[model samples]
Target: MPAVQKSGTVLIRAVEGAQGSSRGLEGEVRYVYYNEPVVTRVEPSSGALEGGTMLSLYGRGLEEGSNLTCRFGTGDAVAGRQETSTMATCVAPPRPVKDVVWLQVSLNGGADFSGSAVEYAYEAGATVDEVRPSAGDSGVDGQTVTVIGRHFGSGQGLSCLFGTRGRVRGMPMTSTAVVCVAPRGGPGAVGVSVSNNGVDEGQTRGGFVYSGDLKGKSAFVYYEGPERGGILVSLNGGADFSGSAVEYAYEAGATVDEVRPSAGDSGVDGQTVTVIGRHFGSGQGLSCLFGTRGRVRGMPMTSTAVVCVAPRGGPGAVGVSVSNNGVEGETASGIVSVRYEYRSGMSAKSVGRSEVRTGLGSGSVYSETL
Candidate 1:
């Protein structure tokens, strides 16, 4: 069948034979080649892009004088739709929705092909959930952020879109979480997305919001040095730590690899603590928690030793940190006794994670007593 432009549309002509009229009244509209062009194939389909793109339509029975018309949705037909004898190259006009539609083509001979628009369909996945950290947390550029949403495992494009001029693509996704690296994004928060099929419009009702930066508070501190997996030290019960971690495969197994102050010595205001451990990828920095309001950091390090300031927080075995630089790793625990505190006497003792480091310092301070 053939398609043509007629009456502002693609028209198809069919031949009919009448026994009473001399085998089709010679010429006119009845005696022409008959058959409407059918949409046989669309190469490189799925017109789901914002920039300009081309489409190739292939069909059988294509003859001279064929015209193709394209439209998005059922709205006003697109103007200036073009076509060749065998194919049509029409630019897709703006659409009011994200959907599937048909491109109708008509042959002057006698055939018409009206096909619906193409859309991105994720065949095997669905929308999952989303995750956001507590009130006072921050993410850095190149740090992995997880978005717990479903239907992202199909290995499609996941773009963490900023406002208008900026975007980061390839956010790794699993069935539960879609992980993306921060791109030094501004305005503090942006939209969590599984591009082409994440949320409804541009809403983040169930998406991740990135907090401002917190790395400025980190002081370069003790590290056992480089390895494959990431090295780690713990501050809270189950937070990702730094140093000694090779690939950041560090888990909540904060046991054997612990940081400790030199034996028989008490942590003073300006003393450096000695650290010991495993899995420290590249120890970034550390800090201490004396009895203060917000956390702070002091001494920074590239190697083992981290200089720490006795936090102003009231006594107790205040927590010390082996601060990791957003790298993944298992955190180990250690202990340090705090002196000169508001809470009076009985030098506080802290075990495993949950120890608070008020400010920046290096080395491990909180551990268990044998």
Candidate 2:
């Protein structure tokens, strides 16, 4: 019934069994659990997190592969800071914060205790209320820019605007300023982008008033050309067809009036072609098989509309239906376009056209396509 003390190696201590505090003896000596592991710094400095971000921790005594947990501020636990054998990598969950945030992880052996933590979040996902330069400004093209939004750090988080192409640029330490050359004619106010971690906020309005009509557009033509009986399309309405083989025909000979598709055009794909001739109106319709679904970059529907591009489909003959709209001399059914490349003396139209392929997928490591 003496105070616990270590003798030789036995740690004679007291034990309060089911009864009450009582004196007892136990083997082995006890010391401090483990040394403290400190977290030093983080990289990329900032992020517009969509959820998972591999946070690299740096600090003294920090070992690789250790269990960890992360929480936003001192409140809700975003994720059970999972443990790994390596101490450096921790997948951070979505936590919205507009200021410098802190993260705490348990260093397997009771190394970190209350009050010990690392700081992150320096920026927050922001909602863009308005932009200073609008979409198209002189110095905007290919220049660093500022995006004004609510919930942003005046400076952090995911601070770049992206287009159809997946490439993204990052922002400065301040959430409000992002540094990246502007893309050609961005769009008007639309969905704002932010990082799930680092910072997050409610939806913020934003847009890219980009130059040229091609900002969010993609246009390509599958063609045979007028010489081969395929329709000839003129994109900008001129004497010469822009060689747009998948001719867009609305007018008879003189170009039809313009009816440009709205910006951010999600054109119809995967169907047949619909040619609107002179007398066409709103009531006209047609049945089409756009090869497979594909997008139409821009289309202006009119009475004398000529649709040259077929839907996203394999290279083959498809059905083209004529309906109300403008039918000056609209074709009745299948407008076959046989692509022929004459080699020696033989006209290879039918023979060469038969070798086309469709979408290919695979079960494992490899896939074949022709």
Candidate 3:
């Protein structure tokens, strides 16, 4: 057999007998030789340290085989799948830290690899710098929250976690910004975190606040006398408020008239209670206060009715107050007359028997064995 330098069509002749034997028959066949694989470049030269980045490799003289493998830096080789004669893909392995590593390919499992190598960079884990509109309504869902940070690269399994409730899928708007919908939660401040690969996470402590408080900034101005000059206040650090305008109006405080079925079970939360009122402003800040215990946000169905959920409390009667501004000292008038009672669901009557009540203060009762 003769060794060929280039890959092309050639004629191969076979001799049946030993060397120089003229009595034997000769057979000729066409054959083609392939050169060693040469990698030209690799797509997505950078990825998260948690890995799971699909890398596309393009090259010449590449062949499809079962033993194909992709090796990243000094890590173990990962199995690769061939997409075409000149294109193959593989998933990158995880790295302990940020680094720039060389990527190599192997055609025969891990025994041998291609001579050419490409550079691949592993980025640092994402960091949370700020969350815009740092506060939101605790009773509202699907509120768009923008997350600003660094090292938020493009990848799968990207999500945002609000406190410890759970995670929601995040959409990457840029390398430093991600958008996520806020989920409903209780009133308080919570930590916010972001994950690019769903394994390693970067968090901001007390990064977001869930509140029933008013959503916008408020200020009180007192004037001694009327003047011709007008007062101008800079907003957003004197940033341009293009396509926006400011206006003022005189808003009257709300007044509570009556509360229906003013009672509920003490053991449950999210009991819908209706507060009949007037001058109830419709917007994001309306809320119902259960004395000084808890405050649940309210939604105004009309100027005469504001609906709210009752929070769980100990058995007793508490004053139900409605506030259109959601401010602490701005509860509506006639609040003392409106009341809600919380009754115990079960009470002991005898040594071995208990009384089970079905509704709020007044309902059907049944005897049960304890």
Candidate 4:
């Protein structure tokens, strides 16, 4: 049977005689009213290309039955459920390519679809690059966090996953930015992720930090070093080192005191060098530079010490410096007395061999197998 284009009553009568003969005998007349399904809108008109997005359709003349199905573009129709006279829902089928497809509803299974159609877009997977204001107080909630990345479609059902703890609704401010309220969490750093449909998620490892007692009278320190995680410090400045400490006492600017060995093989890249410093803030973005040769990231061992892998450089001495902000040439502290001499013939192939080494300014010979 053909689909009903308009809603109205239909009358049917069967004639027993030939046409134009005014009929000899007529059968009983039958009357029926037909109502065409109308779909007004579809919520979350966009989803990931993998599909499995439950779509809610709203309109009139939607009936409850077992034959309802939803069709996407030219693909096979999937089953749909009618919840009321004006609402119906169905799961979208997966598409191999990302594109815009027309969504239509069918009351009689896959036989036909509603006259009106809505556009649904299948997008590529989302990704996260950074989260701004990454650190916040654990005791507070509703901190606004801006997530930067790509492929975020505009619609409802967007959410943010704070570690494995829970999710909060996310609002898309742009294609590359999503804003969400940070939920209350325990003190520590946690991974953050964003999802369009709560199924496929994009994550950033160690993207956020929750601090403890940030506004208290006494100073509190929260640190996450490369080797160890989550170290907290509480100190006193009065007699016996017990009392409420002065504000910003421990927030002094970082200072570089010395670097051990102060020398390495110019051709070796993985040689570990230790830097002794003061007031190295406990967080991300710590780095070191070997003069103008190269800048390498440093791992904080404490407020007074940091470890870094020396970068490859030419033979000669270069001023070593540390940048608490992880930026090159933005040295937090450097001294002319502290220098690392990158010597020749100290390549990796020279290891496990006997050699005579001279101590700086000592003029003493030391026999060692390196």
Writing each residue's lDDT as its tens digit, candidate 3 over 173-204 gives 99889988877777655556787766445644
Ranking by TM-score: 4, 3, 1, 2
- For candidate 4, the TM-score is 0.47
lDDT of 1 by residue, 1-370 (tens): 3544442333344456665553433444432443445555554344333413345666643343344454444453443233544565555554444455555554441133344333322132233234332011233344445555544543444455433314556456455555555455442333344443332222232322233343223222212223211112232543643434222121221111223442212333343333443222233324433323222353443343333444344334433344343322122121222222223443445445323343343334443332
Q: Model 4 RMSD to the real structure?
A: 14.4
What tens-digit string does per-residue lDDT give for candidate 2 at 28-106?
A: 4533233445655655344444445566655555443244444545654433333332345555665554465676555
Model 1 alpha-carbon drift over 4 Å, by segment: 1-111, 114-128, 132-140, 163-165, 171-173, 196-203, 207-370
lDDT of 2 at 59: 58
TM-score of each: 0.35, 0.33, 0.37, 0.47
Show pairs that collide, candidate 4: 67-109, 352-370
Supply the TM-score for candidate 3: 0.37
TM-score of 2: 0.33
- Poorly placed runs, candidate 3 (over 4 Å): 1-3, 6-33, 127-143, 148-370
Clashes of 2: 56
After aligning candidate 1 to the native by TM-score, how far in Å is the CA of 322 from where it should be? Answer: 5.1
